[model samples]
Target: MERLKQITSLASLAVFRELYNSQTDIYAIISRFLNEIISTNGKYNFTLTEITNLLNDSFGFTIPEAVVSTSLGRLDHITKERDIFSVDKEFERTSNDVSSLKDMSLQKSSDIVDGLINYIEKKKTYV
Candidate 1:
């Protein structure tokens, strides 16, 4: 679609800047979402299904498996960590890397939606 192409053409910096300039309350919401994922040491371990359920509950969106897959791929590209995993027969992110998990969760928060969009846009550039 035209929108997808437009999104694809955007640079990562542009994407991040757009996200950073978004409303403050958005960031707060995102931060809260990220905080929820934080374990005792500020980390989380989630399988793809778990993430999908969490996102559905938090954002009220039905994120398709392909979409989640693409998002995970983009996140992996930017973070340069194998946060996405394949377990038994499902995809997952089970690392105890607290900071990374926080970042990913934050990125998925409504407040940081723009940032995540930017991250994905930028990730496309690198690929």
Candidate 2:
């Protein structure tokens, strides 16, 4: 009984760790998808099934809706605040430093959010 409890606890811990690990890539991809939607359609309302299908079709990987929702929580850009989309200030194909202030985000989402808002303002001029 003691060994069984230990095994179960360890297994659950591993699962949680995987879920909590660096999901930066997933967030970035989702952000890009949301941005494209906003740019073309002007709003986003992708249901869980739709997101699951999109991930499978676009990236060839299937993810649970719960996991995708958790990843989306890390995006930190898209919100109900005027439907603003936080985009990378400078997009570089080879750059992984999407967050402002390089790899370190001290002020957290505020900086990146500002950048995205500014980017949106510039985009408005073209529209």
Q: CA lDDT, every prediction?
A: 0.43, 0.44
Residues 22-84 of candidate 1 have per-residue lDDT tens digits of: 645433433333333332222345555666566444433455655554554443212212554
TM per candidate: 0.31, 0.32
State how far residue 17 of model 2 sits from its true place (Å): 18
Per-residue alpha-carbon lDDT of model 2 for 15-122, expressed as tens digits?
A: 333434645465555544434333333334555455556544433344576666555555545332342323343423232222222113323333555587799999
Poorest 10 consecutive residues of model 2 by lDDT?
A: 94-103
State candidate 2's TM-score.
0.32
Please name the candidate that would achieve the greatest lDDT relative to the true structure.
2
Model 2 regions lying over 4 Å from their true place: 1-43, 80-127
Most TM-score-accurate candidate = 2
Q: Could you tally the backbone clashes for each prediction?
A: 1, 0
For model 1, the stretches where C-alpha displacement exceeds 4 angstroms are 1-43, 77-127
